[model samples]
Target: MLIARWIFDIDTIDGRSAADVQGAAPAVVLDESVRVVPGRDGEALAFDGRAQAVIPAAPQLVLSQVFGFALAFFVNVTAPPDGEWRGLLYKPVGENDARGVGMWLYPDAMRVRGQVFTAKGPDYVDSRTSLRVGEWTHVAFVADADGMYLYIDGRLDVGVPLEHEVVPPYGPIYLGGQPDRPGFTGLLDDLRVYASALDAGTVQALARPPS
Candidate 1:
């Protein structure tokens, strides 16, 4: 059975708010909530490239040992300016410090990127391939003792060390975008966060279209 710390699926979709399907954590749609659109599978939550969904900092997300974690989601690129970096998900730590780990799109590189932020420093990795615009693609960001891994369409795109252990960000997770970066303008579906790094096979299985 597929398991995850948090799963946000079609049942969680809302016009102005979203609730985790397997937990109590809820995310508030900010700045004029995005629209709901037919997803590559069942249903998806859409972002306007300017709006976001915020999940407050709580026990469900705040962990002391984030040694290994992976975030997976499906997206359809739509209207990001060429060469711009767009945020997919992030967690803010503080003002002086960069926000916590996040997933973003590097349009120029035509690939997805993963970033981790903590008091010690930050770590990042870029996916090897570009996202086919206007098409649904599955992406994941993973971090463990070995390193940070970026998966695109269920394939390992990048794998690099995540440096040493560092304090995790103590804050909420932002979906679609962050304050400093522009959010993705398109469809987002089947968002999930796992406590442990998922292997390539599991990730590939996740990429399978929902039934």
Candidate 2:
């Protein structure tokens, strides 16, 4: 059984929000199963959990100064047509703007995909690789001023070079499903986000179960 060392204790220095910030000591108590761990070598947040649920206020509530995010989850499929497993990183956009990037796992493959629409319309792109079913796979994205790289189990599968310079604003970042399209389903565990690029050593540390 997995135990949460620190669920929603705001008194600790690593607490999730201002209400829960270290010293404020809010009375928040997360569901018994969810745990947040400090990232290995950087100032990042990571979560470990057992079910498919959303951290609704993830962006504004939890993340600050985050430039890159990654999610690793288990795909439990007892039968055919296994559900669509996707992880998204989103920040607020103006009503007229349509641009962001996400990584997804379809039944056949996994993809590094994104969309951009200034005022003309929406443009989209994707790079996919075949993936195994009903297994726990590590999917990660590292984004900076240069562009984004999609990784599977710590190895680069596809690189989406930016046509123009791209930078992630310090707004709320989301995971698990598209903000616009909710209810796409899967089991996500060990989700993480960082303010800086996670190096190989850090990624390996994150991949390991907490001690």
Candidate 1 stretches greater than 4 Å from native: 1-11, 28-30, 63-67, 94-97
TM-score for all predictions? 0.86, 0.52
Candidate 1, residue 38: how far the Cα is off, in Å: 1.3
Off by over 4 Å in 2: 1-99, 106-128, 167-183, 208-211
Cα lDDT computed for each candidate against the true fold? 0.72, 0.39
Number of the top TM-score candidate: 1
How does model 2 fare in lDDT? 0.39
Ten contiguous residues minimizing lDDT sum, candidate 1: 1-10
List model 2 lDDT by residue over 80-166, tens digit each: 233444443443333223343344444434443544322334334455654444444556555544445656666666665445544
* Candidate 1, residue 35: how far the Cα is off, in Å: 0.9
- lDDT for 159 in candidate 1 is 90
| Residue-pair clash count for candidate 2 | 1
Task: For model 2, name the residue pairs that clash.
Answer: 59-172
RMSD (Cα, Å) of candidate 2? 8.3
Model 1 alpha-carbon miss at residue 75, Å: 0.6
